[model samples]
Target: MNARLPERQASRALLIGSSRFSHEGLHDLPATVNNVRALADALTDPALGGLDPSGCRVLTDPTTPQQVGDAIDGVVNEALDTLLVYYSGHGMLNQRGELFLAVETTDPDPRRVHYFGVPMGWLRSALADSPARNRILILDCCFSGHATQAMSGTAPAVSGNLDIHGTYTLASAPAHETAVAPVGAQFTAFTGELLRTLRQGVPDGGELLTLGDIYPALTRALLASGMPRPQRLGTGMADHIALARNRAYRPATPSTVKPRTVSEPRGTTITPGVRSTNEQDPKVAAEFHAAMLDGYRRAKKELNYNAGNFIQMVQQVGGLEAARRLLRASSVSSGFTTLWEKGRLDLAVEAVVLQDRFAGLFSDEELDIARDRLAEYGYSPAQTS
Candidate 1:
């Protein structure tokens, strides 16, 4: 069966990552903090997870179990379709071998684990009680595989009470294994791989990436890298839920340009990847350069565009070609769609590039793409006024 994407409007996500710990026994995991922030960005990205930013709550280094519990309760109550809860950091097992999620103030002493750490049973209870039709739990930490066991009613922690219907659990490691976190890495081993999978996307996978598609790939990649093999448990159609858009997906109609190698005045080879800055016709490049700067300013002032890489790209590729590249994209560029979603596509650089005055600069196929994308969004050239 084909996986279905969750309703972006009705789904909610809660991301919790404990990066710092007060007790010296529980070493700090700096990568966990970056994991939460980066995962949040990837999930809310317009072209990726497509989740509303407001619906995805991120908690880093939570102070208390109540804080995390309340957040989970809030999302569980609000979400009518799907509820996703992701936790990355330390996972501790008390004297009874029950799993507890460690927080900033959690004590390594198993006796006091209940005081600060959040119990795995609490999550099972919340999921079992939630009205949402789909529930997804992702854990990235030591002994995370115990979560799968807990959900299956085989674990001593929440024995015989794992009645979480329509729930899916993805764990970073087996119950007895400790998840790897390499020193100086930006994110933990499991979460870093997850982020990479989400961003780089599966080249041969379907347009929408489901749990079934991701888990196998993650397992192969992690095991190949000498990391612990991840585990998964899914009930009902939970495995068929789509989590992200395939970044490597191609449209039916191709818009790729085969570049012709050109030599500069000094015999420097300009390949497809090398963009010309100063060698191009000054007049043509200057016109587009001016338009680009104007639109950049307008987008920043009006649409709150804060992407720093955009300016860097303009400088590297030169404004004239940069505008043309956006126009030639098979689908609307994410940056342009971001502006359109902000209710200010009229001020976008793509809009300026598509103007009649600059029509001659771009090919007919390229112009068609730019116009089609705007029209798809119900945007008109007259909207510029």
Candidate 2:
């Protein structure tokens, strides 16, 4: 499991939005402004961590690298406080293999980066030397994954809950892939999901959203949205460093906890990995659900995995009613959990069909294991005949 959260501390955020650039070839990224504002609002909300607005600094379209550096210098020296640096703009890599954040007056030419770009190496050095107990760097720009490799080290998606007391970096895309910001969307693709994770809260039975909770959710959210996977990098006292309180969530109880199963009339209570008490027979559907949990449990042993959160995410993205429709449509009078496991009849087709129906909820490994197990039993997922 990820280490438990460290003590709460004073939190401050620096949000940089560069929508308008001086270079003629570069187009303005209007979503940058939207991304910053949305995040800033979440940070300052009283129901959240109740962060002081004065501690948050947002810079837009800075004219030079010095301006960005000055902003970084202001926050890096802060001690025993949580410091967040978020950049939403264009990012580029120069010939010298340095990652740079494009300044407002940045020249987009690939060869002449020193003119208007802020070196990521400089940013990394400042963060490494910081005295603050909590440090987070979030980059929502192109070539952001490069910044992580430039840092300490890149980590796989966090499995267990842990406090991120040392330093953590979240990059929107890999070193080569381009990040996305749909033209009409209010915020950039990555930031939109970040804010959603904060607002929706993890179902991990806590008011605080930690690094482990956010990264996987962001990964799944981006995959569902058809965007490149986000990457997390760095290591040091990495545990539950609380980012924000989950305002839209409350701990599940015997009363409010919904059954994550198909029941007679389909009662409104659900949790992952277990069934709820509801009468009525949808045994086939329930068997399918059981198979899903079986596959998932096998895939996530080390992680303090919460199947419910993944289900909750699917409900949020596709709507609860839509999910109910799926359960009902897929339900049958007779069921076969044992046969399904043994790859009997069309169980492979059945599993694949179910996967296609709710493809968003699974991670790559979980899906692969499920397929592999069925294949071992002579079940071909694609061959219905």
> TM-scores across all candidates?
0.64, 0.63
Query: How much is 244 displaced in model 1, in angstroms?
Result: 0.9
Assess candidate 1 and give its TM-score to the true structure.
0.64
lDDT of 1 by residue, 1-385 (tens): 3557778899899999999999888999999999999999998898886688899999998988888888888898888888899999999988888889999889978887877799998888878888888899999999999888888787755546555546889999989999999999999999999989989886545677777667766876897899998988776546567788878675454456433322222322333343433335577558768878777787778767754545667889978767766554333343554565467877666677566445445554555566656765568765221
Candidate 2 wrongly placed segments (more than 4 Å): 1-9, 153-165, 255-385
Per-residue lDDT over 1-385 for candidate 2, one digit per residue giving the tens place of the 0 to 100 score: 2333333345667889999997896788998998888898887776776467877778888888899999988877753467788899998877765578887888877788867788776667666677767788899999898877767533232122333347888899988888898898898899999998888886532466667557766776688779998877545433356677766457658896543322212223433433333213355345445555454454345333333433443445433232333233211101222243223424322353334433323333334444544443355655221
Query: CA lDDT of each candidate?
Result: 0.77, 0.63
Best lDDT goes to which candidate?
1
- Clash count list over all predictions: 0, 15
The stretch of ten residues in a row with the least summed lDDT in candidate 1 is 261-270
